[model samples]
Target: MATAEADVPTAALKVERGKKAPQFKGRDRWVFYAMVGIPTGLHVLLVWVPTVGSIFLSFTDWKGIRFSDITWVGLRNYNQIFTVFEKDFFQALINNTVLLVFLFLGPTLFGMFLAYSLDKSIKGTRLYQSVFYTPVVLSLAVVGFMWQSVIYSTENGLATQLFGGGEPVDWLGNQSFLISFGDTYGISKNFAAILIAIAWRHAGYIMVLYLAGLKSVDNSLKEAASIDGANEWQTFRLVTFPTLKPINVVVAVITVIEALRAFDIIFVLNTPRKTEVLSILTTNNLLGEGGGNVGRGSAYATILFLLCLGFVIWYVTNHYKSTEEGAES
Candidate 1:
């Protein structure tokens, strides 16, 4: 009788406690809704709205000024940009592409080299790093002016001293040089000038990025490589490069964007010889460099936007694929 009475009370207490507890299943529902709402609302307002507006403008002949007057021109803008007046469009594309090629090879590779060298103990490392990064802080307008004087000034330009065969040749003004730039330097003066300028600006940034990646590499793997009778080159090849693959991916994406969207430097490089690029070219066309063409400018911008999007998608997809493969292995 005593045991049965004790068991019955214990069961009753358990049931009462269960009933008194609060359910946590739906308690944080408000937090999820709030988070989703804010970002989605902002994206709709900022990105989607502007994108749709630009697309609409592309379909019409709208001078960016005075929205009161706008004409709708279907595919006329795009057709002219690609076919009728292709010189400006194609040339700008080529110049930007050339800059991009150099950017991918020069800064990325050289920066890796510099970072690897600095990975060893060296004197004046901080000073070197500071000096290298100084260019990145300067505005493109300032750099362009400084470099133009150095490259274009026949009497006082540095290129004149080294390359002009005793006198400075107007690097941009001389059509002969542009004609033969490929013959001599394997790239045009516009190509070389922009390549040098961008390298000076971004090389240090790449070095710093690589340095960070280098630091995260496991010290033990390196030591193991060394212990296994591996030389420094072998160790770096086997251990360091593999570790840096992810950093290279980031560097590539940044370099590609910088190359394509680099407007300020090329704009300031406006000489009589070659003052035109896609951004400047399109702007000049819109505002009438020779004659204003608002419809055409929008078309150029549209093309650039699509191209940038395409490359970004390509890089992202490849990056994810590589990551998945690595995970699988």
Candidate 2:
């Protein structure tokens, strides 16, 4: 009876403490509203308004000069994208896919391998890391320009001088194939050359991300695997790799985005023949450098946005569903 009576006061004290906690009143409530409302309003105005406007404009032919100029043509832009512009659209698609594959195979895997190698306390590990990471810190545009002038240039370039045999190779300008894959989608030798520079930078960036992921892994799991007579490769593949799933997802998304938006290096390289990606194609339309085609440009932009949005939505839905299932289990 006494214990039950004592528990009543403890419960009452907790309730009292809850009640005593500060609650926002009149003026404080206004401040809270202002804090949340202002940002929300700004985001709606700045981001959503433009996005909706762009989607509306995609169906219309507009010179982008005035609202009065927009004329709804109803699927004309999309029809051209499919029929008339099919070659350019398909070419950009194939090129972006090539970039995506190259980045995953070359940088993503290479970065993980590098991170695994450096996780061992090798001599001058920091120096090796710094060397690999330096390119990622440099501005891509500047790096692209440097690469163009120093390496790929036809006249007085390092590569030309080295392999010139007194006749400098036109590495960037040569449309002639070193090897053709088909009449259509074989690797362009010049495009492959540009990819070298891209991979160099991407490998370094991915290395840093993977290195951080590797650091967060528990040493005990590795030690346990070692005790089980597991070799280093077996241990990493079975035990460590699973733990790095989050980092893998992040790297995958980054690589995809990078591949899709590859521009600066290709751009600075004067968008050398057959090196076009979606971003460059989209920008060229928006700027009307290939003659004013606002409707077409907006269609491309909408396509890119929808593709990204779809991927994000799918990933988020799957991720959250799995999380909920795991929690329930």
Candidate 3:
């Protein structure tokens, strides 16, 4: 009877202690709250909320001037995108793709060349870096104005005095490069000029990426190849570039995203009505010609956003696939 009474008291004490144990520390509790709250709040506030709102907006005919005036329009906004201005829509898509390729592949290819060449010391390396990177610092407005003024027409412009002696050519209005060959092929001035401008601005940025990638590679491998009597080309193709796969992927993915989102350069070059990119088109509609079609504007924006997301995912996935193989090997 004494033992039984002691056991009952012990059980009671255990139960009381269980009820009174401290739950969490203040700092840890705060961190837990932050971890959950920050990401959840950001996703909801920045991405999900905006996306949901846009979907609803795309279905309405709201001018966005007043909250109470929005009206339901069903698939009309879509119809307008595909049917009313079909040419603009498709042409802009094609142009955007072209821009993506050049803005991405061009920078990748050229940056490798620049990085490889500059990987070693030469005369005035700093000067070359500055010269190449100057365009990057200039605002799109400055770039646009500079190009337009210089290439507007040879007659009044510097090119006119140099090439025509008097008559300035209307460079932007003419086809890209006039061919004198039997089979003449000329690029449109608008595309050509934009291409040059974008390339000039972004090539150096890619070079910086390539420089880092190049640095990450081990030089001992190159020395071993040279000792084996392998030529420079063979060494680079088999050794250095393979190691640079990750950097290339990173640069390409980033470049594609930037290209897809390009607006400022094109906008500064021409009026919204003239350049007519998806971004500008959305802007125009969001402001006016989209009628009171807030939904349509949102739809256009959604398309651009999706396109960028898709390309980024694709490029990054492929990039890492090769990287994983290299890592395993």
Candidate 4:
């Protein structure tokens, strides 16, 4: 049989191989190229091109008018941000830092806990998931309006009804310093309120992410861990959590992006005092009344881009390094 197989003609083998493998030609080839090329082209055109343009504009002085009006300023915009408008810049930066910290501590952890709890096939789990994730589906603008009008309203709002005791508490207006730092910057009461609104929506978003991750976790590992006398927490931390590294990475990146780019809800709330984030400052400078300063806006955008890029690079590098170490071990 080996001799007969070896004696098979090369042309016959080639014909058999050709029967199994097909090649794209004409229309199919064009379709395949379109499927890949269009999206890549659009992404480069819409995302990267604008990013490069922003970086270039960050080093120039322009009123966002005629191209001839542009003048190269060589870090002048950055210098002014640090010197002339340092107060606003620092205030926004602090607010952004606070937001990033809060999201990680509050929503991210809470969402993971919720996902774990819901993954146990408990009664009414679907209903609970729907209820928790409902806020995430709503537009942030709509969420802002809903929270402002119904939940946090000074008059007849649920929050005031529950906590005010009698005097109406301005959930979205009062800017009293809750955590003061000298006379320059502080976490204001209104900003804290906005944080709550942000947390409400963000928690649901995070819960969904973690829930999906949990669903994809293997049951056998969990069963084996249980059989080994590991408690729920231990099993999760060791077995389940380890399996969730990809999900963790995604969640971390998303949390960072969300915290850094937080704008819609705050903007919808008309950007309460002391609640200004980098995005808010960027928008105000880029599109503020009276012509607006393109250079300053681009500088703010560049700063934001750098911050986001820095975190992504750090996290990704650490993740890969740890992964390689684990594999080697």
Q: How badly does each model clash, as a count of residue pairs?
A: 2, 0, 7, 0
Candidate 3 lDDT, 244-283, residue by residue in tens: 8878778767787777777777776663222456877777
What lDDT tens digits, residue by residue, belong to model 2 across residues 1-329? 46555556555566546445333444555787888889999999999897777678789988778879889999888899889987678667777888889999997789889999998878998999999999999777878788888987877888888887767777776655555557765556677778888888999899999899999999999999999999999999999999998888888788888887788887877755677777777778866366477787888877777767866776688779989899778
Give every collision pair in model 3: 57-295, 58-295, 154-160, 154-168, 154-169, 155-168, 176-187
What is the overall TM-score of model 1 with all chains considered together?
A: 0.76
Candidate that scores best on lDDT:
4
lDDT of each: 0.74, 0.80, 0.72, 0.88
- Residue pairs with clashing backbones, model 1: 288-291, 288-292
lDDT of 1 by residue, 124-204 (tens): 888887887788789877888888887667687887788778865766554333433244223355556556877888888
Global local distance difference test of model 1? 0.74
lDDT of 4: 0.88
Worst 10 residues of 3 by lDDT: 178-187
RMSD of each: 8.9, 6.6, 8.2, 6.6
- Could you say which candidate leads in TM-score? 4
What TM-score against the true fold does each predicted structure earn?
A: 0.76, 0.84, 0.76, 0.84
User: Which residue runs of candidate 1 sit more than 4 Å off their true CA positions?
Assistant: 1-48, 65-69, 176-187, 273-275, 288-292, 314-329
